[model samples]
Each structure stands twice: as structure tokens, then as C-alpha cells.
Target chain A: MNATEPKPTEEILESLADAKSVFIVGCSGCPVGCDVGGEKWVDEMTAAVRGAGKDVTGSALIELLCNKALVGIKLGRIVEQVTAAEAVLVGSCGVGVQAVGNMVARRTVPALNTICLGDYQGLWPGEERCGECGECVLAYTGGLCPITLCAKSLVNGQCGGTGDNGECEVSPDHPCGWKKIYDRLKELGRIDDMRRMIDPRDARKRAIPDAIRRTTRYALEVSEQEDPAPASEE
Target chain B: MSKLQQQLEAGKFVVTGEIGPPKGTNIEPVLHEAEEYLKDNVAAVNVTDIQTAVMRLGSMALCHMLIDRGIEPVFQMVCRDRNRLALQSDLLSAAALGIENVLALTGDHVVMGDHVQATPVFDLDSVGLLAAISNLEAGTDMGLDIKGNPNKLDGVPKFFKGCCTTPCSPTPEAQMIKLEKKVASGAQFVQTQAVYDPGAFENFMKMIEHIKVPVLVGIVLLKSAGMGKYMNRSVPGVQVPDQIIQRLTDAPKEDRAKVSVEIAAEIIRQVRPICQGAHLMTLGWDHCVPGIIKQANLT
Candidate 1:
């Protein structure tokens, strides 16, 4: 599930300032779990928008706003209110906001900023995300993924640039990822696990772009059994 | 073996110097500084690669130039601007140019440099780069041939491979862990980030005693009191103690260089008992290397 955080209040209000009426769309999936978007957030946002002196066209909490078909059906149920609004305020992750934009002709504005799940976690529990690098070294790192947590994504170990305060050299705000991994491994009594030398990541393994497609082994087996192609001669 | 490697192997407390290639084509001044001050004073002079990720003349080119001047150059290679193919090719190029010493670094982030918008290419971290160098030494490359075998090099070149560490990092355990990995990956020696506190450096040296690679503690000359304070605030893993900052502040403007050399020599004297050597990074003040070496009695 994608993580999300609320955008600044002033930014959201300013984007919707030109509209006479605003409808709010909240996701009940990941954002709801994150406590930034849900039925409660939708109600709060509607009240806030109304307080800003705009007509409230109503709000709906759609399940899995990332699913276009589901979002379309949910918006269809409130067609009258949706059509009456000049702009839709989406209180979900970037994917959910884009889904609402695709489904409606009205100006869709996002109310939340989609933070990189890789860089953030202590802010919310269980916020770690898999980068799908195709090769996992979680065991060696005591379940901490340096590829995602480290600012430079250094797979071997920490760079020498770690700050004196255990902050990343890139910025004082970011904690050193290897330090966390070191602490975790120490707690697990697996300090020697870090000694295992990991090879450089194969670029081919992560060459998959926006979409990853997989051919099922069942289909491949069935096809091979049904029609075997002639072998080519060298 | 390179002179630095030979000296380390002989149990000599060797000292290395450093020089940053100029931002433009006019490299005479820096090269002259190296020849004038560092040529006979230090074992080898390090030519930084886009030091701090700020773009400048390439390290390889400057390193080749150093060879012509009869100066031993430690070609500092960072994995921030090249992919695996380019890195391997450059390693071969460096060898072809008679560059014996190579320092592998993950490098500082690009955002810290002048060109904030430039992209950083950490295709291989320091450990991986070291492994690659080892592979090259073994007469093979880090690639598979058409027959799915390690590609063979026509005439493999060897180097005195070195890596860097921050002895004063707040995460000392983590830094040690990484250093252990670097040594495991084939790091022959280490030239560390600037170290000011000899006590911290001693502690770090004791912690890394298991790793047999020679470690050269780094010392960057403090040009002024303001630079010391700025380093404390901005330079990661480098903590210039308040007393040293006060020393720089108390020094008269004309005597700042003398005081800076004294501070550097003092740190070297303190750490010389515990470590293999010292790496003097004078920034633009290359003329101070001889004075520091003399004061530290490294000769």
C-alpha cells in the first residue's frame, strides 16, 4: 500500500480558491490506514473547505482509489453532487488523486503529498516499502534494506560521510541507515551477518519500468506440452 | 608495488599529501604546488576526483599529468559520475597511464556540491569498486563473456588499492563494520576523512585492530577560525574540537599558517604511535606540507 501525508493547508486551499463549490474524495485503503485520508478526514476537509466560505458539494470515501473501475463506480453513485462541484479535493496518495482526475472533467486538486516510503518510517509504524530491486539482502542486514533506507542506496555498508550525530551527510534530518541496520543487527546478535560481501546489484534485474509483467509457469508448461516448437540447428 | 605500499610494508610511518585539481584548464598552479612542496616530502599525493562532487578537471587526467612531473599520484576515484563499464574502463586507463595508487570512495552527495542539480551515479559503492579492482588484478573483469564466463583481460593491471573511512563518525560501530567490509572486499590501505581528535582516532584504531589494512589518519589544515567552525557545523563526521578552534582564533592573521601547521603536526605526532601514517589535506595551501612533515618529524 502507498503511504501519503497531508499537503500544507494553505496550498490545498489556494488551489481550490477559484472554485465556488468543492467536492472531497478520500481513499479508504492505504491513506485510511495512514490516518491522513478516510471518512473522518473527508468530513474534516469538507468542514474546513466550508469554513473557507465555499459551498460544500458533499464528500465520499471510496475504497482503493488506485483502482480506476472502483473509483469510477463510487463517483457515479454521487453524480449529482460530483457534477455540481467545480473542483474535487482529493485527500489520498498521488495515485489516488490521479485516478479521480482521470474519472472527472472537473479540476482535481490533491490535498496530500506522497512522501517516499523508502526515506520515511519512524514517523509511522510499518512504513517500510520494498523497492523491488529483484534481489533481496534483508537477511544479511537484519531485515533492514539499505537499498531503500540509505540516501545513496549503498548496498555494501554505510558511507564514511555519516554525521557525528548519526545523521546522513545528505541532510541532518535523515538518520544514517547503516547505523539503524547496525543497531538492529546488534540487537539480533547477528553482527557477523554484515561481514558477508554482497555483489553489486545487477542492473538487468531492476530494468523493469513502471509495469512488470510475468508469464505464469502453468501457461508456459501447458503451451509447451500442447505444441512443441522444432529445435533450431546452429 | 607503489612507494606508499612499499613504505607501509617496511613498517615506516609514511605520510601522504593531497591536491585538488583546479576548476579550469589552468592546472599549473596546483601542479606547481605539488612539485614544490609535496614532491619529496610525502610518499604520494592524492588527486581528488570532483572533490565534494563539484565538477572540475577529471582525476585521471590530472593523475597522468602528475606522472610526467615525476610525482607519485594517488588517483582518487569516486563512483558518483560513472557506471560500471566506465569505472572499469577508467581503472584500465589509470593503469595504462602508470597510476599506481587508487583510492575508492562512495563520494559526497551531489547536493552538497556547487552543481546541486547534477545527478550522482553510485553504480558501485566503495566495496564494490574495491572488488572490481581485485577482479581486474586476477586477470578478469566483472562481466560475463558470450560463453557465460568471466571476461579475461588482455594484460591485467594492478594497483595499490585504498579506501576511505571516517574515524570520528558518531556511528563508530557502524563505521567499523563498513571498514571491515571494505578490507574484506580487497582494500589494501585506508586514507580516512579528516580526523582532529587523537583520542577518538586511537579508539577507532583499537576498534579496527582486527582489520589488518594500514590506516593513514587524515588531517586537513585549518585555514582560519571561521573555516574550523564551518567544518564543525557543515563537514559530516569531522568534529574540530573547541580548543583547536580557539587556537586558530587566537592566532594572529599573519601567523595563521604557522599555527595551522603546528596543529596538524601535533595531531600526527599524537596518532603516529597508534596508526600507520597521516594523510595531509592542505586544501590550496600545498606549501604547508613540508613544514608540517618537518614539525611532525615524519621524515
Candidate 2:
């Protein structure tokens, strides 16, 4: 499932300050589990938006907000109310919010901040996944993603600040990600995988940047092809 | 080679000191303390970069100033503030300025610092940073030559590369594994997180027997009993035993500094036989380094 958290109340209110009417779009997928972008969450957000004295034109909880076709058909059901609203407040992952923004002509504000995972989630509910780093050392790491688990996103190994209880130094309550990798590798009799030094993650090799910018890929590709040298008389 | 590296190579029980650059331009007092108290006693003084993630005068400038004052500085570069390009450029700058020792760290998360709202740039973890240093030393940057070849550097810079470890981590194997990676990535030396337990340190040293780099045990001077208790409660992988805290608590208010020095010196004595050196992190008490050195008979 996708992980999402609500934007701060002040930030959400400030972004919607100029709009008198707001239409809410909630994702029934991952956000439901997070309790921030589901049907219940949309209802709470509607009241909260109404509490701020803005007129909420309508609210719709789409089964998968990230699915652009579903969002298009769903918005079609409430076309007049969606058009009447000055802005659409999306309670979904960044992908879903972008989907809503693409379909609507009005201002689309995000109510939630999408949590990036190392591994892109599929239909299964497991927490771990590939971080999209160019190099896949999962076989060596016992299938644990250090990039996703470690607060520092250290791929080589654990940092020196691991807590006394095998928790992360940044968040003591969470178990150290590298420790989990070590335990899993040990159980599999592949502890030697932890021995080799994982080279510095080449950001050039990382897939996240390209994945995020795919929507604007054509514009980026055109800009890369065009040189900005001015024709001048010497 | 840096004096610290030379001493470590010569099998000398080298002692290093740490100093944090101030938040503003009024850096003379801290520099003066280092020059006066730390310059001669320690092999090299580490200038912390935005230490504890608090924004401050950059470590490179302070390190250069230390050089101006005839004191060698271990330029501590944390991967918390700069991206890879900036980090690589700074490494070249440190080398150009004649700063020899470089300690790479992942750095404390920004949440621990004064600028909690600041975005942390972990573009490179410590292992990656250490590798970057190694790459720069090999006359290539972390980037390519556009034709998929390693980019050549204008001039190669040599540094006594160092990495840090937490000796008493709950997951010792994880720490050890990272230490091995750091060494493999060209960490010529290691300085650990503040370790109070001599017994635990001995065990850690034994565990890392395969890593040939000289290790300097970290000893952050406990300023007071309250500080020790605070560390025990809040600081990770750092446990200050009760007897030491009790000693600090019982020491008459005037003798607290002396007790702290004595305690530090005692720990140094305990760990000296197993480790190569002691890294005295006096925090703000620079004057205590000389006293600890004298008490530990490392003068």
C-alpha cells in the first residue's frame, strides 16, 4: 500500500485561503490504511474545511485515485459541483493528486504528502520494496532494502549512531534497518553479503528522479536537445 | 602525511581533540582555546561540520584557520549539508588549503539540531563519502567524463581518510560490518562515537581485529552528573555507568571538572592497551585535554 501523511493544518488552510469553495477527492487505496486519504478521512477533511467556513461543493472517494481513468469517470459523476468549486483538495498520494490536477482546470491543492518507499508497492501489503537505486544488491542484502529502512538511507551498512536497543539513531522506537538486514542475512547463511562494500549510490543511476519527472519528460528532453548559445557578431 | 597519520603509522598512541566551530563570526575564542589548549597536546584537532547538524561556520574555514595558527585540523565533513557535487568540490578545496586529515560521517539528522525544519541532504552516506575521497585521490571524481569514463581531476589530493563507529551498539555485527566497509572504502583510520564502557570497548576492539586501521576510542568529557544522566536517557549507544555519575554528583561543585578529567583519564588508561589512541572530545572544556593527557601519562 502507498504511505501518505496529511499536510500540516496551517499549510492546508493557507493553500485554500483564496478559494471559497473546495471539492475533496479521496483515495480509497493506500490512504485508507494511513487514515489520511480514505473515505472516512475525506469526510473528516470536509468538516474541517467547512469548519474553516469554506463552502465544500462536493466530495468523492475514488477506489484508486491514482488511476486517471477512474478519477475522470468519478469526477464526471459530479461534474457541475467539481466545476463550481474554486479549488480541489486532494487527499491522496502525489500520483493521485497529480491525476486530479491533470483532469481539473481549477487549482488543485494536495492535502497529503506522499511517503516514498525504496520499493514501489504492488498489490501485496508487505512493507519492503526496491528503492530504485540503479544497483540492486537485494540478493546480497537478504532482500532487505537498506535505502528504505535506514533513516540515513545508508546502503553500505548501518551508521555508528544505532541505538542501544538495535533501534535507529534518528528514531529510537524503530528497529535499525541494517540490523534487520544483518539478521535476515544471518538466518539465510548469507552473512557474507554484508561484508562487501556497497559503492556510493550514484544519483545519476537512481530511478526516482526519472520516475517523478516522467510527466514532464518531453519538455525535459526538448530542453536537453536545445542549446542556449546566442548568435552574436564577433 | 598528516601528523595524526604519521603518529598512527609510527605506532604512537596518538591523541586527537575535537572542536566545534561557532554559529557566527565570533570564532576567535574557540580557536584560541584550540591553539592554547589543544594544539600541542593532541596530534590533530577535529573541526566539526555543522556539528550535531546545528548551522555554524563551515568546518573547512575553521580548519584552515587552525592551519594558519600552526595547528593541524582533522576536517570533519558530514554528508548532512552538501550534495555529492558540493561534497567533492569541498574535498578538493580542503586539499588545496593543505588540510590533510578528513573524517567522513553520516552526520546527525537535522531533527537533532537547532534547525529542525532544515532539509538534510544525505546525498552520500559516510561510506560513499569515503569512497568519493578515495576516488578524488585516484584523480577521478564521482562523475563520469560524459563518455561513461571517470572524470579526471585537475590535481590529485591526498588525505589521511578516517571513519567513525559506535562501539557499543546493540547490533554490534551491523556496526562491525559497516566498519569493514569503511575500511574497504579506504578508511585509513577510525574514530568511534563516545564510549564510556572500557569492557565493552575491549570486546569491540577484539571484534574488529581484522580491520588493520588504527582506532581512536572516543571519550566525550562529561561536564556534569546531569549531563551524564542526560546522555544515558537520550544519547544512543552511550551509557555512563552509575558509579561515574555518582562520582560527578558527589564531587564538590568546584571539583566537577577535575572529576570529569579523572574519569576520562581513567577510561583512557583502561582502553589504551587495546586501542591505538584516545580521541578526547572535550566538548567546550578544551582546557581539560591537557589535564587528561597528563593524568593518563600520554604526554
Q: List DockQ, one per candidate, in order.
A: 0.51, 0.46
Q: Rate the local accuracy (lDDT) of all candidates.
A: 0.82, 0.82
> Model 2 residue A189 lDDT?
61
Question: Ten-residue segment with the worst summed lDDT in candidate 1 chain B?
Answer: B170-179
Q: Report how far off residue A85 is in candidate 1 (Å).
A: 55
**Top DockQ prediction, candidate number:** 1
Residue-level lDDT of model 1, residues A12-92, one tens digit each, is 787677688998888887777668977789888988899999998988988777676777898999989988988788776
Across A22-132, the per-residue lDDT of candidate 2 in tens digits comes to 998888887777678666888888988999999999999988776777788989988999989987888866556656755765556777755543344423323334354
Which residue pairs in model 2 clash with each other?
A: A118-A130, A118-A131, A119-A129, A119-A130
For candidate 2, the per-residue lDDT at A46 reads 91
- Per-residue lDDT over B167-283 for candidate 1, one digit per residue giving the tens place of the 0 to 100 score: 898878778888888888889999999999999999999999999989999999989999999999989889999999999899889999999999999999988989899999999
TM-score of 1: 0.73
